[model samples]
Target chain A: MVLYLIGLGLADEQDITLKGLRAVQSCSKVYLESYTSILLVDDFKARMEALYGQPVTLAHRETVELEADEILRGAHEGNVAFLVVGDPLSATTHSDLILRARHYQAPGAEAPTPVPVKIIHNASITTALGSSGLAGYNFGQTVSIPFWTDDWRPDSWLARIGENMGLGLHTLCLSDIKVREQSIEDMSRGVLRYQPPRYMLLPQLISQLLAAAREHQVDFLDPERTLAVALCRMGAEESATRRGELVRAGTLAEMLACTEPDEAQRRQDEQDDEAFEEANPTVSEKEMDARREARRVQRAIDFWGEPLHSLV
Target chain B: MVLYLIGLGLADEQDITLKGLRAVQSCSKVYLESYTSILLVDDFKARMEALYGQPVTLAHRETVELEADEILRGAHEGNVAFLVVGDPLSATTHSDLILRARHYQAPGAEAPTPVPVKIIHNASITTALGSSGLAGYNFGQTVSIPFWTDDWRPDSWLARIGENMGLGLHTLCLSDIKVREQSIEDMSRGVLRYQPPRYMLLPQLISQLLAAAREHQVDFLDPERTLAVALCRMGAEESATRRGELVRAGTLAEMLACTEPDEAQRRQDEQDDEAFEEANPTVSEKEMDARREARRVQRAIDFWGEPLHSLV
Candidate 1:
């Protein structure tokens, strides 16, 4: 009997490695830890069950943290599989699980007996960011930005980013995800009400980042020239990468908006541009430069479809 | 027609994702890029060929660098798969390949028409280091430690490590691999003769790091207390990690030597310790403390079997 911590890669169920799939098939009980990050495909559980020929229980944060003993007991009795969205070891919580598995005591056992634990590695978003045409080796520490509430705003990640930037290194900022959270009023009244899931998009991340930048009074490159690479749904067919400046205040939304155009609008713009170019064959170099810039922006917005709609 | 740059994950053929396997099965040609790192399996090409049912070609440095046009042409005619050991984009050379593929032109084409390139990501050694029980998010910029030949020792990586240490971040040092290299004499004689392939092991890396630390005159924690975690054959069945101190000069070898134990020897040692403890039933607290320390060291030496033997 063993506890297998398997990584389900960055995208859909197809991203699971053959080794991981084999392990899942061998396991009697399988769990997909679902609160950290969302998978990119629909009917994920059904698809995974179909592929692995095994039933999978969705383990929310509470299930993992509060009912870890139950999961460990399953491993104690038979082979168990714990599936994660990205690399299994990418999160501290999973590492803690491994540690707990090592020290778990059975109900009637006199002493602690370690469970045989095995990890199946897979692609993580931190390394998958290399798809953005940025050098992965140049990236410094990865920082996460939490969704800000009225009384809970933290800017420690800002200092880490600043340190990385000062060292001429890149910083990977992991977006926040809020899931299965109860409101303060509901918690005080001993209610079991939960709020809807909220995933922090690039717009919200940018707004918080810009606010921290201003409050810290750090001097950076010119607003128009300081570029950031925004990646959405990486390792999937709908993956998109955009390199654009981090403009401050209200214009930030406008800057993000113009670059993201629907496919029909983009096609129409290309046609209109070609027609104009044919009509004005002897256009000025300055105007041609502006057209090139516009095209560059348009090309950068390659596949910002439904996934990026919330950013607007 | 498309060029699929698929990652083969860290271990063997079984580490390839289902999507990657399907893509390879559909490809007309498959080439395994075999320079940056070595796959941790025997008969790698044969195993992959068996799994994919496609004839596999080993693409060495010369084949990829000097004959990329042929690969691009293969993609232009039909789908081709270029398999990499780790994540496809982890290395700059692969990024260059992607760029070249984008800008490649057919022999008689008037302009460079971009060919669609798809990257199927997998587990890279960088992210796989999370198995060492270190937080992946705490890692700083990754640096490379090249083989230090006489009269050509570079220490720029020292500064980068120092920067990371200043920020209290872990630095990942990628070991260098020298394959298909021509010696100075061979190059001077206009010969095609090549030198034997060389991999920078932990001992050599430690030697160079200590030299850099001394030359730079940087203050570090006590040598007995300062530790380094060395990982080998990650994401494989033989993967091993050892945490030991970075002592100076001669004793460094002794420190590394004492920790690595073969299974039989480890079992024998445990039996010997038990026998001694039983003989001396009322041992002093100081002797008991030493026994505890020995057990901790022995437990930490877990699974150092065949993989870490080279570290000595």
Candidate 2:
């Protein structure tokens, strides 16, 4: 019996390695960590179930963070699979799980019984960003930009980027993703309401970047001349790479204007959505809301399609 | 027609994604880029042939750098697969091939016919180093340590590492690899002779780091106290991670002494090699030489059991 932590490489279900697939098939229980990143393909859970010939339980933050002992218990009894988007250890939280498994002990047993753990590595954004044709050797530390709230805004990550820029090294910036998050008000009030998932779009990311540059008065990024590459839906069938300079406010829209869907196209997409709802009436409301949010983002950003967007 | 640059993820044949495998199976001709990195599995070609049901041609540095036109020609007429050990674009040379395919023109034709290039990403050393339990976000720019030679010993890469350390960030140091290399004297004499391939081991890497630190008079690295993690054969079944402090001269031997093979084990390995040679008398001289070199490397590196070794 072993605890197998497998990485589902970026893209869709098909991106899983044969080694990972075999491990999934042989497991008595399989868990998919779903909140960190989402696959580009639709019906991901259904498709994975069909392929693995077993039902997969989606492990949300609460499940993974609070109920890990149950997962280890399953592994202690029989082989269990924990699937993560990208490399299993890419996230620091998952590394904590590895440490937990090492020190796990059966609840009833007097002695400690650590469950054996194994990792099946797969492609992660840290490396898949190489599609930008940038030399990995020259990339400085990776930075992540979180979404700004009313009272909480941090610019330390920007300083990290500046440090890398000082050495003429490229920095990999990971955009923010808000999944199953509760609003501050809702949390404060002790309500059970949840907000719709939000994936950071390029326009918002660029806007924040420009705003940060102005506020921090950093020379690392030239508002009119700094070059950036926006990689969207990387490793997917319709993946796109766009290279652009960070220009003024007007230039931002102008650069993306050519690729923006026109009024007629937007109307057609809305009509198609209506037709889809009529055709598949059984679809859950949550799924419909997510799809509509994705469509709204598509109209806002010009060229990108699908999700799991990143920048370099 | 598409020129598919498929990534064979770290470890063995089964590490390739289902999508990559499908693309390889559909290709008209397949070429394995062999000089940049080598797969750990034995008879990699045979295993891939068995999985893909097709012959795979070995594309050495000469064939890929000089004879790329032929490969692009195959893709121009039909689908072709170019296999890379890690992520295809991880190496700059492969990125050059992508550019060539994009601008490729058909010979003896009136107009240019650029072939479509598609990349199937996979796990690379950049991200697979996550197995060390280090956060990818804290890693600074990657640096490569080249094997020093008489008259030209560059330590600029050391400076890059020092910069990373100054920022309280981790640095990924890629070890040097020499394949199908010809000595300067041999090249000057117009000789076709080549030197045996060499891969940088841990001792040599640490020795170079310490020597450069002393020569440059840098305070970034403390020879007696700087902590370092050595990641070897990452993503493989027997992948290992070792953490230790960078101690003085004699301590290096003391740290590695525990993992070193004993005299009896060395004798057993030599006897096993002799028995293998007797069993497979028809094996090529080049194959035997490569095996012997790999064995020598194993004895030099205490814990690493494969050729592709990296450090963080």
Candidate 3:
């Protein structure tokens, strides 16, 4: 019996490979890693359970970090499957899990046996960024943008992005996700208080990035001339209804506005889909309005689905 | 009808996702993108054909670039599945193919109609690098190492690697693969001659890297202190027989020698598999000699499998 660290690819349950699904189906216990990233769809857990025909326990950060002893014991006794969004080992936490499972390998020389862990690879947003028409090899260091507070604004990521830009390389910016976060005061007082989940939207990220640029006065990237692409619900094209969207804009502001819920619609002919307009010329006025509104809402939610931006 | 750019994940046929496999099954014609990278297995084309129950046409660089008009026309007529190893758009060639497929959208307001291309994502070596204990977020711009030639050697990739090292970021080096490369002399004569494929091995890559370091005199990465890891046949563990090996070393030079044909076998009790070593312990001297010879041959072939190296 071993610990199976499996990756559930970007979109939904069906994104799991046949090999990964087979591991989940027969494992003694199943866990869906929740804190790092979600499956980019509503009811991801339920859908995964339906596919596996087994209940899945949510593995929060604390559960996997502080209270992993129980999971390790279960793995020692029987095979246990731990599913993570994107690639299984993308997050250092999972790698730490594998390391923890091999506690004996740390200090003890030859005393205790170790619990083996097998990794099943899957598509991660890092690689999926190629869909933006930027070559993966051209991408430089990946940076994360955190939500800004009144007093705390860190611009360290700007210099890294500038370095990448200096080399004419694309930068992959991973937007921050505040999931079940606690305030510093609450943590200091030994109180565990929950805050609403927050994902950094493209608009917020771009705005913050621009602010950082202003502070740093860096010329590596230009706000008006820079070409950027944004993705939401990556790898969800096969999903029945809510197929995701990839938005490429001439500038950061344009890309941000492309997903704005209340932004005025660009003329269909002026958009990237003149061909689409040509294909559906007979669409009615009211139907077109409804479709535009629906598309706007969809784009907004999808932008809100998962936040990751790239600049080339 | 659409052009489906599907990723055949790292390794062999079963690595294709159910969604991608479904697309391939239903597509009128299937093409396996042959350049960029090949599957890390023997007879990948025949294997995929047997799995899909359809013949897979090889889409070489020249065909995909020069004669893509025919392929594009076919996609307009019916669904065309273009299979790429690792991920669909990881290579710039596929991205160019997608752009070429949309060439109709590049002209006047009333230009010819354009066909749509949908990309189905899969695990790529970029994401698969997480299998090493390094975080993907720590990787900087990926660089490629080409086979060196007299009077034509280029070392420009060293600066990028040096920049990443300066930032304390890991560099994912994509070694070059020369499949059907034409000599300049042949090209000058308007001759279309083909050369055997050549993949950069660890020894040759390390030698060139060391030479570049000496020429540039960069101090960021130490030849003796830098840690490195090598992988072959990623995403193959779930398959019944082929289990890929992850080689880790404390130094680049040590890692190079790790793949050498000859290294003393560890003592039975000291090795990872006590049983296997124990089972083979005290074999006849003649049998041991034959086993060593066979291991030398196996290492030669495995080093020839696929060409990609990772460092952190």
Expressed as tens digits, the lDDT of each residue in A1-312 for candidate 2 is 899999999878999999999999999999999888877776889999999999999999999999999999999999999999888888878987888998998989888899988888888887777777788888888888888865888778888888988988887778888889999889999998879988787666666777888899987676456777777767766424522222122233343453466899888978988898999999888888889766756665545543555667
Ten residues in a row with the worst lDDT in model 3 chain A? A303-312
Q: For residues B177-221, write the lDDT of model 3, one tens digit per residue.
A: 888889899999999998878766666677778888888998755
Which sections of candidate 2 miss by over 4 Å?
A239-298, B238-299
TM-score against native, each model = 0.80, 0.84, 0.81
Ranking by TM-score: 2, 3, 1
Native contacts kept, each candidate: 0.83, 0.83, 0.75
Model 3: per-residue Cα lDDT at residue B235? 69
Every candidate's lDDT: 0.77, 0.80, 0.76
Residue runs of model 3 more than 4 Å from their true location after superposition: A104-110, A183-193, A238-243, A256-312, B104-111, B182-194, B238-243, B259-312
**Which residue runs of candidate 1 sit more than 4 Å off their true CA positions?**
A238-312, B238-312
lDDT of 1 by residue, A226-300 (tens): 567666677765334322212122234444554566799779878887788899998887797788655653444
